[model samples]
Structures are given as structure tokens and as C-alpha cells.
Target: MNKDHYTYRVTWSPEDKEYIGLCAEFPSLSWLASTSQKALAGIQNVVAEAVNDMEANGEPVPVAFADRHYSGEFRVRIPPHVHRALAVESAEQGISLNRLASAKLAG
Candidate 1:
């Protein structure tokens, strides 16, 4: 897979005084540079080398988030007491329990 298809994040490091680039799909790899662009490029090069090494060693590369599918729905179970409290609160707010729960979880 091409490096462009992978996820790259560049964040400032106060301790290091430089931008740090990390690849989400390749969690073990990172790069630090003076500029965000250089950090990103460094991480991409690292990922390329890692991919080549893995292939040479017959190891599999990770699939990035861009290649995955998310349903945006999941099931969870909570205690009965919490459920009752949320239901009452949702009723008082004049909104469905699902909406209330979603809002609470989001924020």
C-alpha cells in the first residue's frame, strides 16, 4: 500500500520543541522534526521501510482506517439503576432516551 493511504498525525511536543509525526496504523513508528511537513515525510519514509522489511520477512502490513468500514452503531449494557436514572432524565428533558444517551456519550 502507498504511504499516502496511511494516516499521519503531526503534533507539537513541548518537551522536544519540535513536531512529532505518528502513524496510526503503524503505532510503533514515529518521527520528530523541526517542521510538521518534515515530520510527516519522515514518518512516511519510516512506514515505507517498515513495509518493505515486513514483506521481506513474510509479515503482514496493517490495514489503515481509510480501508475500513464503520457501522456507527454498537450495543452496550449498563446497570439497571443508571438506566432508570437516564430514562427519567430523558423524560424530563422531553427527548428520547437514545438521543439523551447519545448526547451524553458524545460530550
Candidate 2:
């Protein structure tokens, strides 16, 4: 959420049968998935993995949006049942739902 960083939109495309993810400002880093949530999850996982891999290999992580900016928000709508479960689990762990989701996905 840095002001100088860029944000990407990950969306579902039924025609492609996959989630379509791409940075509006960085077109080269695009990916796809089968659902909107999955696409968002995939992009986060892929980006984190890529960063970790680069760090492991002693390579500099790419910074395509060092000075770029974003104004829109990204939304990933989960089912009501799933949201309830996440809320319960997050409370049990004493963490916010967003933190819980991020930790689960990062793992």
C-alpha cells in the first residue's frame, strides 16, 4: 500500500477459463486463473514466490513501479460461508481476517 508502488488487477475471465491478472502499469507481469479469488491469490503467491526465488539466487528483485501510483481498489469476493469460517478462524488466532488470509496464502 505504498504511495509510490503500483497495484495490479486480477480478474476472472470465463472465456479464457482462467483468472486473468496483470499490472495495469506493468504488462509484462501477467498471469491467469480459473476464478477471481484464485486469480488474486495466484498473483500474490506468484509475486511472493518470484521475490523469494530472486533473493535466494542473489538476484535483484525487479522494481517496475518504483515511482508509479494507483488510485483504485482491488476486491476479492468470497462466499458468505467462507467468510464466516475465515472470521471465526481469524478470531481464534487473534488476527484480522485479511492477515489470516494473507498468511494462509503465503504459506
Candidate 3:
């Protein structure tokens, strides 16, 4: 996998009247451009350079979380009332609470 495949977002900035490019893996880094495409490209280029610098300096590269695999399992903590409601609804629908919740989350 490419180490430079970091998550990025391009958002419009009303104040600057430009698009702001941001990288999730490097919160401290950002770029601005008049167009969203330019913003995205600029941030990607910066991220590539940063990754190269890290490699040259023997620093650990940030992992791209979207590339990670996941089991269909995770834990969620809900209030007692929410938990009870979900369980009751699932029971009424004749489905497991996990499946019901998973479907809701998927939507």
C-alpha cells in the first residue's frame, strides 16, 4: 500500500472564498486554492512530500486507516434506555438487536 494514501477533505471557505484542503492524518497541514480540484491536488502533493521526508528521516509514516480490514464486530456503549428500546424493537421485528442496529448504521 502507498504510505501517501492519506485521507483528505476539500471544503469551501466562505471567509477566504477558496477551497481549503485538509488531511486527516496530518491535522497541522492544510492548503488553499480557488478550486476544489486544485485544493485536493495541492494537499495530495504536500502529503507525498511529507511522506518522502518522513521516510528519508527514518520517521514512522502515518497509516491510512481506510486501508485497514475490519471484522463485522465492534462494541458500542449506549444508555440503558436506548439499549432497552433497541432490544424491544428488534424483538418486535423478530431480529437480533445487533442486526437491527447494524442495518440502521448502514443506512
Candidate 4:
């Protein structure tokens, strides 16, 4: 996997008083620096090293989120009461249950 293709995010960490860089695909890894740019560079380097190590060990590397395909469908289990309430709401709005659920999930 191209480490650059992995999902990256930089955020301020109040507890550490530093900017934190994170990769979604490698949740266990993070980088902290005084500036966001350094934090992001640090995390990217770390991810590159990790990917190299994994490749050397013949471990399967994770597919980047950008390279993965997703269907519009997924399953979720809610309590019966919540299900009924959602059904009622969808009915009142004259929309299908799936549409209502999709809107709620997006919000």
C-alpha cells in the first residue's frame, strides 16, 4: 500500500500541548510535534517505516481506504423500540426505511 494513500488527520492535542498526527488505517500509531506540519511529516515517516518492516516480514499490508470499494449498504441492529420509532418516522415522512436510515447516518 502507498503510505500516502492512507487516511491522515492532524489535530490539536490539549493534553500533550502539541499537534497530533494520526493515520486511520494504523490507529495504534501517532506522532506529536510542536507544529502540525512536523506532526504530519513524523506520522508519514513512521507509517513508511512500518510498511517497509511489514513488507520485509512478508506481512500483508492494509489496503488504503482510497483503494477500497464500498457498497451503499450495511447492516445495523437496533432495539425493537428504536426500530419501531424509526419505522413510524419514515412512514410519517413518506420515505422508505432505508432512506430515513441513510439520512440519519449522514447527519
Candidate 5:
């Protein structure tokens, strides 16, 4: 496993009443479950699926996650349109856009 591939963080959500999982390195891969343990298990399955799919398609698997966890931060500049969309989403979900964005980025 490469040490610089990608990492993710799983968080618990009260409104949704589930444990949400996300991987920023794999932006499209995420899952949720009723419990943290279940959510982590689900994440493992999701990762396996992603790896299997990538292998079947002859794509390189992202093995960095196996080496170390991500623990750094950076900044991004979102367009106004995207910011508005995120704000609307945050309002509808009853969560702060900052939290949502943090979760998304941590993933």
C-alpha cells in the first residue's frame, strides 16, 4: 500500500439516525448504517467493491488507505453556484454547510 493514496473519516448523524461513512479520496464511495460498527463494516464492503471493480476494469487499486490515515488540511475555492447549492442542501438537512463540507472533505 502506498502511504500517500487517500484516507477517510466516518461520522455519526442524528437527524438521519445513522452512521455516515465517507472517503474523500474516493469521492463517489460512501455509506451509512444504524451503528458505528455497522457503518465501518459497510465501509469495508464498499472499499472492497471499489477495489474489485477497479481490478476487473484493469484500473490500479488505491492502496494508500491501507498504509496510513490522512491528517492534514488545505483550502478550496468553491464557485458561488456551488456554495449556494451547498447552503441549500445544508438547510434542508438541518446541518451547517461547514460541517457538511468538512465531512465531505474528510472523506
Candidate 6:
């Protein structure tokens, strides 16, 4: 697994007063540093070490989000009242429910 392909995010932590680095694939692991660059590097190194240990233990490695395929279709359940309102709104706008929902989500 290419650790570089894993989704990494760096954000400022007001409480910690430092930049926090996070890996989506390894939610339990994190690194913090005074600088965003250092925080990112720290998290990447941590993820690399974790991957090495997991490999040595013959564990299945997580597939990076960048390496995974996504289907456009997904199912969502809404309250009946909300569903009826959406249906009415779609009709008022002369659009399909899926189109209205997609537009709302994208917005």
C-alpha cells in the first residue's frame, strides 16, 4: 500500500494551539506540531510506521480513499413528511426528485 495515497488532512487546533494532522484511513492516529508542514510530515511518518507493523503482523491494510472506486448511487432514508415536501418541491420546479436532491446536496 502506498502511504502517500492515504487521505491526510491538516488543520489548526485552537485548543491545542498547534496544527493537527489527521489520516482518514487511520482515525485513531494523529500528530500535532507547531507548523503545518511538520504536522503533516509527522503524521505521514506515523502512518508509514503503522503500515509497516500491520504488514509484519499479516493484517489487511486499509485501502486509500484515492485508490477506491465510488458509485454515484447511494440510498438515503428520510422522514415521510420530508419526502412528501421534497416531492412537492420537485414538482413545483418541474424537476425530478433525484435532480432536486442532487442540486441541493451540491449546493
Q: lDDT of each prediction vs. the true structure?
A: 0.92, 0.71, 0.90, 0.95, 0.77, 0.97
Which regions in candidate 2 have their CA more than 4 angstroms from the true location?
1-6, 12-15, 24-29, 64-107
Across residues 34-90, which tens digit of lDDT does each residue of candidate 2 receive?
Answer: 777777666666666666777899987656565646654457899999999999999
Comparing 2 with 6 on TM-score, the higher-scoring candidate is 6
Q: Write the number of the candidate with greater lDDT, choosing between 2 and 3.
A: 3
lDDT tens digits by residue: candidate 3, 2-79 = 845678999999999999999999888889999999999999888889889998999988888787777979899999
Q: Which stretches of candidate 4 lie over 4 Å from their true place?
A: none
Where does candidate 6 stray beyond 4 Å?
Answer: none
Query: Model 4, 18-81: lDDT tens per residue?
Result: 9999999999999999999999999999999999999999999889899999997789999999
lDDT rank order: 6, 4, 1, 3, 5, 2
How does each model score on TM-score? 0.81, 0.44, 0.85, 0.94, 0.50, 0.94
Model 3 RMSD, rounded to 1 decimal? 1.8
At residue 90, give the lDDT of candidate 1.
98
Better of 1 and 5 by TM-score: 1
Candidate 4, which ten residues in sequence have the lowest lDDT sum?
1-10
What's the true lDDT of residue 71 in model 5? 63
| Candidate 2: residue 3 lDDT (0-100) | 18
Tens digits of per-residue lDDT for model 6, 10-91? 9999999999999999999999999999999999999999999999999999999999999989999999999999999999
Off by more than 4 A, model 3:
1-4
Give the backbone clash total of model 4: 0
Native-to-model Cα distance after best TM-score fit, residue 84 in candidate 4, in Å: 1.3
Number of colliding residue pairs in model 3: 0
Screening candidate 2 with a backbone cut-off below 3 angstroms (N, C-alpha, C), the clashing residue pairs are 18-33, 19-33, 19-34
